[model samples]
Target: PEKRKIISRFGAFHGSTIMGAALSGLPHMHKSFNLPPLPVIFAARPFHYLDGLPGEAEHDYATRLAQELEALILAEGPETIAAMIAEPVMGAGGVLVPPEGYFPKVQAVLRKYDILMLSDEVVCGFGRTGNWFGSQTFGMEPDMLSVAKGLSSGHLPIGGVIISDKVYQCVADEAHKVGVFGHGFTYSGHPVTAAVAAEAIRIYREIDLVSQARRLGDYLHAALADALNDHTLVGEVRGRGFIAGIQIVEDRATRRAFAPELRIGTDVERRCREHGVMIRNMGDVLAICPPYVIAPKEIDYMVDGIRAALDETAAEHLRTGQLA
Candidate 1:
């Protein structure tokens, strides 16, 4: 049998196409659609802030997750498993960054089972995490990784996959047998999109984009910590480089979140827009992924606006007696 089972994680958002939707593990992405489950198995999300055991060390948590993955692969039969796909820093999963040693442990598990590791770099690619790819920052040795969004800096929309030499050899051998690989979408390589992506790469090289993102990322995370780390409603502020996530909670002590009807994330997003910053809100997590070229002043403005939004939202809850 062809290797078919691929491992993804809960709270993941791979893409919106049929196969991508099947790859995704979020309900919102599957809204209004009745698609059957593909051969994708969902593993645990690396949400240490929420899911970590009380007082558990980060390294131990990573080991536990790796053991869990191994259990899945064993039960499913490793030979039937093709690859385990993951975002280096889970973007749609509220920018969830795994425990410090998580990827290496997970990669070890994959190696034990002879399963491939695939990095979904759509959101964390191209200096988002202060590196050319989040995989580099996190030390994930992926057999293949997908790239988009930053490929053309959202200017024209293009994506490509890079494969390891082993995978390439297999592909080349198969293509030799068939004359050419017959895998593609109608717009697989639109000339204009390719040109735009090429230009984006050139500009990135010209400006030393990676180092710039690394420096600015440090400042952005520091600013966010200074502003919101101790806020009453903020459960967590996390990210690297130009990306971040603010976890909102009704009670910071127990990490209790507001009810779904509150739409607290959406309110923060609206307020942020009013104050001239844009944030992507997914339920209670407010995500910020500013452009790599953002100045320190812009980071300040964005963080300030989010703080105000949280304050306003908290005040409303207080008035309604939903918060104490």
Candidate 2:
């Protein structure tokens, strides 16, 4: 049977295409684009910070998420589901880093239902996630992994899919029977892009940037925790490696996000830029994804800038009587 339904999680940002938008669970993208309706199922995101229940341990949270996934797959009829696509670290969806055992348990459920696990490594690939791929960082054994963005280190736009031997064999046999495999884009194999990507891969190995990201990530996370964990507006500080998010909240004790109209995230982002650092905000969560080559002093500078920006933004709000 041709399994056409692919499962995604809430808050995921795959891309901006008809098919990609359909696979993504963000409502703004879907409504704005008038995305073509496609067969896509949504499962709960394993965001421990926001999604985990009170008194729930990390492993327990993982177990609960896995159970929810199993339930979703069963309800949808596992056979009809072709694949479950995920990012090792949820980037645009608020830098959601899954619990320690989350991926392994989720993969076990997918295996029982004969569903393929697809890893979208566009953001977490090429040393951004402290590993060659986020799959390695998170213990995900994906049947196929899609990577881009970091392939040419954002120097060239080239994306590709890596498939396991079993899947490749099936595809090869099908193409053989059909006499021609009709697929892919005109820029798929452009020599310039290929050359640039190849050189980038070589540089990654030569400098061992993955290890550097891992080491620097520890510094970044720790610095962020020390500086902002006790702040009134900070609800959570979470992430791994170079990809991270700082959740801004109206009520820190309750972890209630600031309303979109307040534009807290955008305001903080502007403040960071004014302080000589640039970051993006998804609603009230500020995302930080720095270069793999960033030095310790640079990390300090960026984190410091963010701290100052937060303070400035808070002061401005207080002065204007906008903060409650």
Q: List the residue pairs that clash in candidate 1.
A: none
TM-score of 2: 0.97
Candidate 2 C-alpha lDDT tens digits along 1-324: 768899999989899888888878788888777666799989988888878899899999999999999999889888799999999998888899999799999999999999999999999998887888999999999999999999999898999999999889989999999998878897879999999999999998898888888899999999999999988789889988888899998888788877788899899999999989989878878999988778989889999999998998888888888777
| lDDT (CA) per prediction | 0.90, 0.90
Residue 320, candidate 2: C-alpha displacement in angstroms? 3.4
Q: Which ten residues in a row have the lowest lDDT in candidate 1?
A: 28-37
* Residues 51-138 of candidate 1: C-alpha lDDT, one tens digit per residue: 9999999999999999999998889889899999999998888989889899999999999878899999999899989889999999
For all candidates, what are the clash counts? 0, 0
Give the poorly placed runs of model 1, Cα more than 4 Å off.
none
Q: What range of 10 consecutive residues in model 2 has the weakest lDDT sum?
A: 28-37
